[model samples]
Target: MQRQFFRYNAKSFPKCYRELATSSSIFLIFTAAIAGCTNSSLATKQQPATTQLFSPQTHLASQPPRCQTAQLSVSKVSTNAGAGNVAVIYAFTNKGSSPCNLYGYPGFALLDSKDRPLKGVKVIRSQGTYFSKQQSPRQVTLAPNGQASFEIAYNQVRDVGQSCPTSEKIQITPPNAYHHFTLPEQINPCTGQVRVTSVQPGIIQ
Candidate 1:
């Protein structure tokens, strides 16, 4: 009697009811696939934004432009003459209309009276008490017509038989700069080395 009752119920069910159960399973599967596709699309859209948030290029893009040689003017302001040694402040003025940044040490090369490059002389960088005691290179932003300075100190007297040549003109390249300017002044590197300080924001002692 139980087997007969089960067969009667199965035979009496409508065809649409069976189709509804099958379609319900298919609807659930399609819904899950659609959700997964939406999640994948969101991740793809967010990946580039995440990479750009931490990229170094993004940081560099926000910094001020580097100073160029043509935008600067170099001059000799004054010098502190001591016993057999002198400290000179070379001032750099930003002559351009736009602002720029300067950091690190300026490149110094010796020149003869005729403004020719003199090789073999080393320009030594110093961290003496004459300048600010910053251990690291500090970025100096210069507005139009603003000034910055660096110092060069060396002995005026050299030991006998040592070669200490006199420089008539000095070529100075600002920090991280490819271009240079020439200062028409005389300097003597007694030990073949001129002690230079990094570029400071203003005129330093």
Candidate 2:
């Protein structure tokens, strides 16, 4: 009777074993999906921290002086007949070891024998390749031990037989971003007794 009972259970065991095997496979697939999502979240959290470490910093220095010295010499002068303009040429050399940036329009004031400011003296307006844009005035960047020339036009004539002393001063303004230097007043020595003659046109040669 016991052997007959064992044989009856063994014949139905195949169906029960199939149900157990299917359930085990579904459980394993669900566990793998959960693990993949967990790893993806970890990677996203670390990305921002890595980017912050390599970001650049923002900092700036101040501007330097425009011209190193107060001394400037007049290299050439001429008159324009059509426009009634006087073209003045100036040569500047870097006496120091550093470079400089020139700014502002050149102005001239005629002086009498006593160095008094003479009115109505025209410093002709220059309309040439050298005229700087109103927004960004003429700026010459001189290298270490470098030299540059500046041309300016004025409306004033060199009055004939009139003994007048002429001098020029350059004004430098700092850049908009930073302020490192001051635009101090620089005065050139008087070129004594410049006699005005007939207005002519041509190069200073």
Cα lDDT of model 2 by residue, 90-149, tens digit: 444555666665554444345444445544344333334222222224455656655554
TM-score of 1: 0.67
**Per-candidate RMSD vs. true structure?**
8.4, 11.4
Candidate number with greatest TM-score: 1
| Candidate 2, lDDT over the whole model | 0.42
Model 2 misplaced stretches (Cα beyond 4 Å): 1-29, 36-46, 49-65, 69-88, 112-116, 128-138, 152-205
After superposition, candidate 1 runs with Cα above 4 Å error: 1-61, 129-135, 160-163
Model 1 steric clash pairs: none
User: Which ten-residue region of model 1 has the weakest summed lDDT?
Assistant: 127-136
lDDT of 1 by residue, 1-205 (tens): 3554434564477899878878999999999999999999998888553343567987887787988988999888778876777788888899999999999899988899888876656888876534335445689999999999888888778787877788888899988888888777778777677788888887775
Colliding pairs, model 2: 122-156, 123-154, 123-155, 124-153, 124-154, 124-155, 125-153, 158-196
